[model samples]
Target: MKFSLIFLLLALTSCSKKEAESERTAHSEPAWDASFFSPKTGEILSYRETIESISPQKNLPISPDQIRKRVLKRRQVYDGSELIEGKTLHRYSIYHDGSFTEGFLFHWVNGFLYVVGSFTEDQKITFANPPIPIAHLNMIAGTYWHWPPQAPAGSGSRHIGLEQITVPAGTFDAYKVSIRKNTQGKITLREYWFAPKIGIVKEQNRIYSSGHLRVINTIELSDRSTSDTSDTSEEAPSEST
Candidate 1:
């Protein structure tokens, strides 16, 4: 009887120790580094974009003739930084064919990269409520997170896995992440390939309407330059109307 009692005590102690270790592991901070996406102040990244309208319909805003097989050049410049809601966010000015299109503000916080806000044509800043989470710095395959915090199931971003991709710029072992959003009857899926210290190497956006595929737009890194010289070239022809 004494031996059985002692055995029971040993078993209980082992279980308690395991439970404590599991709790600690669950609450521990994840390993991540925001520098993986930190770009220099003067960094300039150029990309080649291909926009295709797979199944163009009359109701579609873009006509069938607007679909272009040719690739267009786009540029993004890390021009400045700002302090928003106590967070330091970097501003990226997006240009298409030398014309200013828009700007995005990004920042890292609590092991996550977020799109804190965006800039308008007049350089006005509009912040996102609760800031949209872009990627988890320490994400691994099967890791998942969602924006708006209370979004429904399956409406979120997931780390697909690591993939070796080749673009016009070069080949890189990038982490593939997928973000899905469903609104009304429309569904949009955006996939991003990020290379360490190089930011987004490729992006593909697929939009569907009423359960049918409609458009697929892809942007791949074609060239990157960190030259401090100011851009003064004339605007190139626009790729899309």
Candidate 2:
């Protein structure tokens, strides 16, 4: 899965946040911003991910455990950059649950960050606009835009505004972005707090069925490191909206 909020998003479930934690994320303090989504090799960013079930339905129909929250640690490393189609795309390696899996590649087209490409099924797939827009740096408050314009009916996003948020990684004056779409009676909601130079500091994704929440995945940054190691791996398949 292309877990991009820390540059990836696929599908997920929902869970409730700890009492104290819930209060902090509710901060509505207005905020203001740096830059590098592109990093040197060996740069590592780690997050604490919590997966929880919000409805009676299990992630899998036959599963027995239906109520609970499970936390996992996920890390991403900047492997390097490559020239694809005459443009530079950064490659990132993902590590989660003590093992390596799919990674992501990002490139800029006319100044906007587009995922553009990904690795999947042992093959590489390249495309146009991705499911999400990294940032429209020039965007100001009250901005609205849609991703993968071909998104299902009702799918879209908005740059809500600037907000100050505090998490394990520290406090950041970040941009608040929200995305949502309802299709075939299923709805997906995603919100992200992104820091300029550091990328996504916090994010939450929720899926709903028949107007009821089904699952949620929340990720918060815990730590980060920048180095020159070459051990990182790569993600993703082309998605057509």
> What is the Å distance of residue 69 in model 1 from its true position?
4.8
RMSD after Cα superposition, model 2 = 17.5
lDDT of 2 by residue, 69-110 (tens): 889998877766655444566677777886777778766445
Every model: Cα RMSD to truth = 16.4, 17.5
What TM-score does model 2 achieve against the real structure?
A: 0.70
- Model 2: ten consecutive residues of lowest lDDT: 232-241
Model 1, clash count?
A: 0
The estimated TM-scores of all candidates read 0.74, 0.70
Best by lDDT: 1
List per-prediction Cα lDDT, in the order shown: 0.75, 0.66
Question: What's the lDDT for candidate 2?
Answer: 0.66
Q: Model 1 misses residue 59 by how many Å? A: 8.8
Candidate 2 Cα deviation (angstroms), residue 100: 1.6
